[model samples]
Target chain A: MLNFAPTQEQEEIRQLAQSLAMEQVRPQGRSAEQQGDISPALMKTLTQTGLTTPFPEEYGGSGVVEAVTYTLIAEELGFGDGALAMNIIGSLMGPLTVLLAGDKSQQQHYITPFSDASRGHLQRGSLGFAERTGGYYVTEISATIRTEGEQYILNGSKRDVIHGGQSSPRVVLVRLEGTSGTGGLCALMVPLDIAGARVSLDEGKLGLIAAPSAAYTFENAPVSATCMLGQPGGSGVLRAAALYNILRAGVACGTARAALDYAMDYARGRIAFGRPIVSYQGIAFMVAEMAMKLDAARLLTWRAATSWDRGTGCETLVQEGEAAQYQAIKIAKSATIDAIQILGGAGFIQDHPAEMWMRNAAAME
Target chain B: MIDFTLSELQQAARDYAHQVALEEMRPISLECDRTEKIPDSFMWNMQRRFWAGAAGQARTQAQEGEEKQDNILSILSQEEMAWGDAALSTAIPGPGLAAPPILSQGTPEQQAKFLGPYMDGQLHWGALALTEPGIGSDVAGMSTTAVLEGDEWVLNGHKHYITNGARSDLVVTFATIDKSLGREGIRPFVVPRGTPGFVVGRIEEKMGLRASQTAELIFENCRIPKDHLLSGRESSKKAGFKAAMGTLDATRPMVGALAVGIARAAHEKTCQWVQEELPKGFSVYKRREIELELDEMGQELEMARFLVWRAAWMADRRIPNSKEASMCKAYAGGLVMKVTSAGVRISAPGENSESRQFLQKWFRDAKVFDIFEGTAQIQRLVIARRLFPEVDIP
Candidate 1:
């Protein structure tokens, strides 16, 4: 109803996440950037927020949380550290398949563990969508899915998968051979511990330094029919694309927000050419433009999230989500780049997080 | 305590102002621009509505210590007015730029004698003469001179781009008695427009804001009574230039809000055009892209508005808002140009369309919002200076 005021619960959650970010995630991310290691401490802090729990009431989740709230939460996490936020969202999105489409039995076994703290440490779930070749587009993925009697065989490998080398059940996207439309692409939950699945030596990607990623191969990894989400024969392309876009947009918005806040604080203090550099129209206008794009990205991200929550049709949701993703990527990359520009030579150094954010935004995955 | 939602009362005032802008100002906007002269009746209509918004006990009641929010309401109302016609908003009968410095620096007698003329009966005007041909945004670099002889003061100066300087009942002229003392010796005087030797110089020939007058004022041996001198306290006398700068804390937000309004108008018009007059074969993807663009403009407008509101709120609360004020001015002033330019692109993809001409006019108008009342660069410098108050950068 044309309101910018978040609900009490949303505000509370935002504050909690903000504190976690400022106290834990941001520092952890900055320190971890040097080592290329994901801090288990940051992950534990995230889990403690109860956000990592699957969207099921019976399993101890807040139960079917609103997509808008999730998007807002994702943004706050991003504000803490983009790469770290990406890791958390990617992990959460991995199990989202089972939560949204799996049978009751699968929810109890696979998703309930993350919700029940009594069940020990939070079990990580990895969603692998990118491949070794082509681009980041999920539709253009090269992996193949085949049907054989009571099992499904998945062939081909994925590169740059977040937490890929880690021991977790990975939700892999595959193009079905000899299928049309909705039945074309398929998503399968493959436990990497099984035979015919191999994890490669850690690549420890330079980009998105907060999330440690590696390549993995699947040579005809057999998956039971029960492991498949939705109807035994289902469409995955639009659904996957929509969800991916929503999550990415949220992360991008958060990063842009952080970049703006940092740039403003710096502009206030940084003096150059006998006055504050911010006094220069060229720099001031650029900062203003940065703020404009950042705000735009956030609004688009929120709208996409709202569409995902309230939209009755897949087409509408997909369209909004895709638009959000396109804007988010542009905004994040530009905002971070402009932020670095505002920071000048200091931006290129490791002391400021702008360089790190610029790298993460450049990836735009 | 922190929220972006407007109160019901604020929303109602906004709605009323919005209606007036769309229904009243929008109709005569183009004519006003082309003729370079706003209709007199239209301005009176605006002043009455603005006065009702928060000026006094009219239209609404104010509880003690609770936010009267007159400053905020004034800024928001300016936004609505600008949305209809930016030039018309400037033309609204009031003190224009002269009110701030005079109200702050002028003595009680000087204030009543000078400000009363503009606030009362016949809708007169007052202007501040500060900018010079060689000096822009440099308060201390003014070349005007003032000398005291017996009980009268002789003023000599040239003020360029002075708003309402040609027609105002009084012009607040800033002149230094000693050039060597620079800012310290500078004092403001109430030079009645028709005072001896106070002549109106050339009017600016401009690209946009043509509907509003930009006058060059010349004061050669202009003399005024000693009572006309705005000598306040010793601290204020010492803090002359700084006090004049303080006036911006009250008014920049209004300018910022106006900029946001202009951007919103262009954005709304473009969105309507895209939906109602879709170019042939505008694909679903392209439609979605346009929607995204519209969303971007909306977000930017909202962000700029919040900055304005925050700055205005601080001004009303008497909180020091130099930093906040400058930030708002910088952000809104810069984005309005881009937002309008984007609108021009979408509504007139062919490079020349009727819709493009409308938006192009707005884009031109938006440029002045950034250039005046301390340019965007000047605002940024103010914000930076606050941040680095301790750092004496050479």
Candidate 2:
């Protein structure tokens, strides 16, 4: 049963996403990056597609929560524009975390708002997993959380918190008090407006400008004990983290694909020495390698996503998901660089999407 | 419905190949590399076993009315066989690289004449000779000439770097009838090993995969019946080039699989050394760095395998996969070089055991994966032409 074709419904979803990407998302990429935010209209269109509302049906969602579907949508949106795609797909971090690690009551509380169609586009959820000091490995996280009577006291600073400045609830990984390494890890849902919690929007970034990020400083921020996701020493947080990597890999694949297509088109049209530039092995080979790498990255992402949906063990999920992310990031970086190289002087400027993709690819890495 | 699971038959083939690799190949691997030859007894024994298994599988497929899984089966088994030793794996007695063109482009009579002996459970090899001493990737510019005289075709040329060329029972030789016609005048003829004036010249001494013989074949007034021409027809402008490319497309992924197998072997060996022999006092930070490096290696190997599998799968389904085939070969070619290089670097400052020695051998063997079948650059050219079909790259 080693099949590579998507199911009918998945194909339909792919078509819908691809159309949205080309018709709407791609056109607004430059403007969104310039304005440092996605246009509300485009956001609305994304929301109406029901891609951003993956949760339990009772919690005002389509209730599909399928990793494959999510990845497919992410790739298409990413193809449109990496930053805007992040703006849309990154919104899933918080709600998805709650659905995966939160208790039923927690899921109802945090995920219901996402399904509110009218405000869904504006309802962004953030995941505070990255740290300024630690390596990407879970054991390197230094943030801490402690239980005090009926509340959990959180004390940590998280950098690169996507949508961190927003009012929506967010999930942050923390080391349990007096514990170290992965065994001591916990995920706690923190409402950004809570006491002793401060959120500041990051002013400057190398890329991904359309999806603004914030830094979170929690100094003894108190949260109700019910807000704890899964158990204090459970694998829930690990699963959530792994899923994040897979999703990001999907976006990376999309961005790389975009850069490759754009470069191939340019090479086909741009003539040199009495022939199209693509006729020259110099330029054609670059495009070909880009296409191959992009395909390789996408296939890896898809495999990882499928593994997640099949309820594979947490260890396997983390390994496959992270591997996919690693390759996708590398491909995105190289594909954009090659695309720029193919375009020559014209690629250095903003007239074409190649330069923007290069910057976006860098930021993604 | 994108699934990565192997069918029952493919899995069985893979497992069996792994066993053969471990038992039959690994023991002789180092010695063969040193001596630059695989024992004839070893080749014959392996050949007998291979034909038995192949015949069984063919019968099973025919009985079950299964879709052709030969491509998938070949790659799956190739990876494992190569994991034991890439050189010995190539040295295995079979049709080698000539099967694709004969099966795809040759007339039924030609196929029967050239390929029938491979099924007799005897040691035999078939080769595809395209690269010459002066030309590698520019296949259309080859100077090998084939001129018609009566009912026979006379070929005069030198083809070098031909795997199994010296021992092959038949070599599918490429020659140009008219150099001025460029690719159009090219033709491939089945030149039997004993055909008059078909000479096997010096066997190359290589950095790695030395057990796999590379021969310089000279066709000096070598003549064969006109019917020996694949497809038994006058050369169409695209036929010769297309047939050669078609052969590469079918075989390139299998080559990629061999590279993956070698990389996996090196990576696995390095991992074992690090786990078992590394100094206990190695700093945690340094250990983590090594772990990250290993992680990247594993990821890259997985990516390369996926590419190889997809390409093989596409070929099985009869899908036009020229670009995909090149993609897998190009990616896997570069990937093996990187992984094997890392293997040596990470495994350094450790015991100089036999396994560690093999690591160096693998690093040497890894280079040709990127160089042969199609060099990495040539693969990109093919891929680019596919990507922008309108560009008309020569």
Candidate 3:
């Protein structure tokens, strides 16, 4: 069973995603970043592909909930363009949380609209999980949720909430009242329009410009108790967290792979000392190391995604998922830096995507 | 379909190697480094207890129609053995670098003559001589010369930094017949021990891996029968150089695994140190920093191992793995250096204990992983050439 080959269907899907990435997503990456938003037309094209709606079919999705498939698509979209890929994948955080942890009624109310083909692109969801704290570790969740009669009072500030300003139906991770650590962790789906909730669009970000992020501050924002994603002690929120890490890792792998490809092409064509610079061990080795790191990161990401889809134990899922993200982010940062190095002066100019990628990779970390 | 599970045989190989590393290598690791030699008795014991049995079983399995999983099995065992102590693991008796070329390109007679003794349950070493006094990496520019005179060939050159060269029973030596022909003129001559004028020159004093001897071999009018020429005279003139590269392709992943093993050892040691030595009530921020450092080390090591395994897997399946082989070597080589250096940094402020000493030794040993087999730069060139096949790289 120590095989490295992808299944036939997985390979086919990978190819399809790759084509969309190369032909559609990659081309618009720069413009989308410059504008600080994905074009409406391009978002429509991506939405029609059902890549953004991976919920259960009964909830108006393609029902492709396999983590492996999601990762594969995430990687391809990442390869096409980091900002665009982030924009597309970031939009799914809220709905995926609802689908994973919400009761049936919650899913129908929040997730069903994502499956509506006509208006799905506009029905974005965001996850407010990260806080300005120690790290991305879930045990670091400091946001608080308290039950009051038939409603829940939310009070906390969330940082790095992707699409927080633009998306409705936000799913925020919070610790229950008077509780500490992971034992009291839970998630609640809150509408962005709710009173006492404020969303501030973050500006001057170093990268992922197209997939803009915002910070959210909740001041006693009360919502129906039915909005709770899962039971207080349930495992659904944990699973969703693991899936988010894996998907993000997939995106990093794509970005690293793209950086390597671009660097290789540039090195192959640039002439110096009467030969392509790639012929020199100096340039060639850097490119090679980039390629190696990219592949290594991709394999880790894939393994984590596969383990998730196989319904392996939660420990294995969290460990692999964390490792994958750690490596993917590191490699993405290094690979983009190498890409810029390979491009020389052109790498620093906006005329090339290497600089953009370098920023995006940093943002990913 | 992608999976990371090891088969039963691989698991056994890993466990058995780990046990040997734990019981045998760790005990003598520092002593060997201090003395700059592995005891002959140890080598003999390993030959009889480990290498001979393993090699003999492999032969028997091959004769019994079992598929060869040599590449994967070798890497798995090498990683574990190296995890014990890289120098002692490398110094274990058997054909070290000399097996690949002889097995792949040697004639039946040559194989019988050179490799047959390794199966006799005796302590014997086999070395491959490619590096020389003035050249390294630039294989085509080697000045070692082999000239034919009747049925015998004369070899004259100095090969240094050769692993196991001082004690090798037979050395697969590379020498060019025509200086102007570059790589095409290279020929591999099997020079047996005690051949006239074949001298073991200097035994190097090194920074690390001191248990494994690094010898300088001098061939001053050394003579061997033409029959000892690997692949014989009728084979393609390019075969010798190709075989040299082929051996590198096969061994780089093994070297990568060895590097990973060393990193694993250092990382594990650092982990234990962190658990036991850190003061109670350490600052939360500092603890978080250390935690992130440890996490990075663990992730990087896993990534390096996966790269090594994938390359070995490709080699076992007989896929063209030159690029992947270099990838693992380059990545693991750089990675080991980083991890070992970090290991030393993280474990600092401790008493100069045995564990701390080993950490320092490992840091020293990690450097050569990037320098030998193929330097990180050389591997990159190989990878770049493969990536852009349309553009010729000299």
Candidate 4:
């Protein structure tokens, strides 16, 4: 009774995403890093494939894919380039959340822009929720929202927004006035063309240079009443917490895979004392340990996502939370660090992606 | 590609266990757990349900194939017997503790004669005497010796921590038959009760599994016929160790299954207690703690069950299962320890505490699962050795 097999479609998507990442994302990722902006071109291509809109066709996106599929792509992209992968995977959360709970009209208005094949691949929107002061907890959102009639004006800013200003349409999570903590926060669709919302880029981030990290200013930005996602006043904020846990787990796994790839390749190629470094137990054991965690992480992540898709039960919720987020994050942090260690001094330089991977993992944390 | 479904055979085993657990044992489980002992009559009732009775009343007539029921007879009817206090389950004769190695390596005639008393309702205590005083993890390092004397095999050594050793009518003693071949030189011999040189030295006062007798068995010139040798192949001492260790690969999962039963008892008790017993406004935080612990324990139990089934299934299928068995044993054994520990933590010392009766005993019982059927460290060593043959196990 415990056959947990993935369908062929999931495998196909995973393969396609992995190939795309290795071919297009990894190479261009470096340039994006140098330019200090996440590549909009890459973002457009992802949206074009309906990769960003993994929801049902009724919601202006393909509903065939599960969260696991998105996670696979995210992990692969993370493996290729952490920053770019974050931007790409992080962008889909908006589309995903809307698909999950959005009303039909809102979905058509917000989702169709990017899903339209005729648009020749639009830059899918991004999610801007994390702020400057809060380290890990999402409870404190400095962005303020004031309601006047049907409209709620967003006044505060979001710092460290991945691909902040570049994505055409993005979802900004803001806390409404007269409410405290996470309970008051509501997700709103914010168009980049809005005059009051301003983006100030943070330069020379230690890692994921390809991912644009910035400080945003939303002074009296007006948002329509229909833009609010979920039940406006109730448990809307709490209901959406599972998505972050799942997707972040995917990011962790994908990047860990990439780290293993680099480390393994290096171990095989580099020789010392008339043998490959891999011949040494010191290196081989680390590689083995990495492989073990990577395997376990994959199983745990898949279990979490599959449980989500199946609507198994509440018993699975805490399990999914631990496996998908906590374990994945730990693995991502550990694997990247180990990958860098395996490479020794060569990994420390900007030329190799090892240092970059380590930094990106830090960002993931 | 492995079929993970519980097969009809396994379902039958589980069904038998379920019926016995529900009808006979469940009612008295709380009482037995509290008293930490099961009376002889209750044990006799269990013997009627399976094998290992007092007089010579075999539980059931011969089954279909009927070559001989020795193998089945020797096995501790573990599924059914585990129903009534697994600790007490280990105490009952015939199928309880002595049959594993006998079934694994016992010669055909040896099995029929030595393992016969239990099936016939003649109360025969059986013990698998393997672990030595200094050699809990390292079975190969057993200092016990068996020297050949004419047509008799004379055993001169001691076995420490033999379950049911003090009362067992038969002892399946593992000894070094030939020192030169190391592990290959070891072999098992069936030493009947009241043998001149064989003695139950001292019984240890254990923390839990309190009703089962765990004793040190000493052998001094204990003489048995050459035919008493369990391994018919007549291999070296090194081969004997391999044979004994292999039996453990099969039985370790059974040990893990026992742990599973004990943990299930704790989990089910705690779940019922938490739901019905907690008062209003009694710290939602504490309730949350119970909830989370239960959830985690449930997950661990499921995973442990999967491991146990996988190991047992591999064996039943006649597949070489040393590695899979090791994995199952390690994973399940570790999980049982964790679950029992959490059971004690959440259920102790509160008005609504559901863990009042059995958690402490289970906590103690849990450690034995990790220690007895090859320590956790040993299982890991076996896995690491198998997985990376070239690398020295750390």
Best prediction by TM-score: 2
Tens-place lDDT digits, model 2, residues A129-246: 7777863456667888887899988888888777878746677888898886556777787877789988889887888889888888889999898778877877777778778888
Task: Note the residue pairs that clash in candidate 3.
Answer: A285-B380
Worst 10 residues of 2 chain B by lDDT: B54-63
Cα TM-score per model: 0.72, 0.94, 0.92, 0.68
In candidate 1, which residue ranges exceed 4 Å CA deviation?
A1-37, A45-80, A92-121, A125-206, A212-332, A338-355, B52-65, B102-121, B147-153, B225-238, B274-299, B342-357, B390-394
Model 1 residue-pair collision total: 0
Question: How much is the lDDT of residue A80 in candidate 4?
Answer: 70
TM-score of 2: 0.94
lDDT of 3 by residue, A141-221 (tens): 788888889998888888877888877677888888887655677878777688988888999999999888998888999
Candidate 2: segments with Cα more than 4 A from true spot? A175-185, A193-195, A232-236, A271-275, B53-55, B62-65, B232-237, B279-287
| lDDT at A217, model 2 | 87
Model 1 residue B169 CA deviation in Å: 3.2
Error of 3 at A216 (Å): 1.4
True contacts kept of each: 0.08, 0.76, 0.73, 0.07
Error of 1 at A119 (Å): 6.1
Residue pair clashes in candidate 1: none
Give the alpha-carbon lDDT of every model: 0.74, 0.85, 0.85, 0.67
Q: What is the CA-based DockQ of model 2?
A: 0.68
TM-score of chain B of each: 0.92, 0.96, 0.96, 0.87
Minimal lDDT window, size 10, model 3 chain B: B58-67
Tens digits of lDDT, candidate 1, A169-277? 5677776766543346666777777778887755545568667676778888887876676554443344655677788888888888888788877886787766767
Better of 3 and 4 by TM-score: 3
The alpha-carbon deviation from the true structure for residue A36 of candidate 1, after best TM-score superposition, in angstroms, is 6.1
lDDT of 2 by residue, B1-394 (tens): 8887777777878888898899999899999999997888888778776888664674477357567778888899999999999999988888889888888888888888888888886779888899999999889899999999999999999999999999999998888889999988887788988999899999999998989999999989998998888974344677777788888899999999999999999999888888987777889898889888987878878888999999998998899999899999999999899988887887787778886788999999999999998899889988877777766897
